[model samples]
Target: MSSTPINKPSALQADKASATTSANLPEHISLSKWEDSGFEWAGQVASRSFERLNALLTTEHLQSDLEIKANLYRRNNVLHLSFTLTGEVWLTCQRCLQPIAIDLTDDYDIALLDNESQVRLVGEEQDCLLLDEIITEPAPERLLPLKKLVEDEILLKTPMAPKHDDCEMSVEQFGEIPEEEENENPFAALASLKGKL
Candidate 1:
């Protein structure tokens, strides 16, 4: 009988793995290159999720191990951003009144637009994001922060009131239940006095 040895990865190994995954991701990108060459960018980010989320998430103390994948490319004269975010977030369960870990995985897509006029033209018929700065007539070479864009997508997908679907909670969580006993109406006594008069 041959015994096989199991080797566990060291902390350094894990860090290297994460570094390799995030190596290709850029915090910023040139809009001109993205549009002209139809450049494609893909990267992974592992960090404290809530800092990037800002006010979008009401819950605090979310786990620091967040993983997000972003892909940006230009197609059909339109810039497309695709993001996949996965993390264990802490949210106060409405029913349980206890903190629960919610596994979140969101895939979002947005069409990037350079002008407000384009937004008006596109309207709600399409998912569009207007660039913060105007893309001059010739579309000058300008770098856009990819992190901000990715954060916006994550915020949009976060839940407003996160709660467990199967949380076991009594009606008391909402409010005190009224007793079934009926009370004598004050109007009844007034009506009796009026009848005697």
Candidate 2:
């Protein structure tokens, strides 16, 4: 997180797309159009940077309906990108181990794309490529396997179920958990007579 600054969505190159190519662009995403980041995938054209998620990419939960947004741009003879992910998911409690279904909003830093003869692919890190002043063949177009990325991300990040900090078992029924042994005298009445003596 140190080397990679928490850049606002403006740093992405997709912002430029909104200003320049209004005709070509589709229903544009109004949130932060990250222009500095980039993405790449097979067959598709270059990509813009996808906005990284705010939450940690851990075993969380993925909503039944998942929606993710990404951006693509060209840089250094290569396609770059950034993107964001949003949706709801079901989760289990950590402590109680009960199901705690909740919606989630996450972002990703798409940095590279694999471009074989067709297009390039991008990763989650700062991946750059040679775009200008290149003597070699026209660098393959960068593309993002968004479906795979989304599926993988959702699978990896989404948890089976949400969890709570404490156990759910009620006091009346301890369930499987055993109770502590109580300390008591075996013969309190006899012991009382001995004490008197």
> Quick one: best lDDT, which candidate?
1
Root-mean-square deviation of each candidate, in angstroms? 12.0, 14.0
lDDT of 1 at 35: 43
| Full-model lDDT for every candidate | 0.57, 0.42
Tens digits of per-residue lDDT for model 1, 1-197: 21111222255335435544554456566765544433334344544433665443334555445566555555445566666777655656777767766566777767777665655544375677766642323435677666766766665555667677887885545678778998899899999999799
Report how far residue 36 has shifted in candidate 1, in Å: 2.3
| Model 2 lDDT on a 0 to 1 scale | 0.42
Cα lDDT of model 2 by residue, 106-197, tens digit:
76554343344213333334534332222132324422344444444555565554455456643364558777899787798798899789
Per-model TM against the reference: 0.57, 0.37
lDDT of 1: 0.57
Worst 10 residues of 2 by lDDT: 40-49
Model 2 lDDT at residue 57: 29
Pick out the ten consecutive residues of candidate 1 with the lowest summed lDDT: 1-10
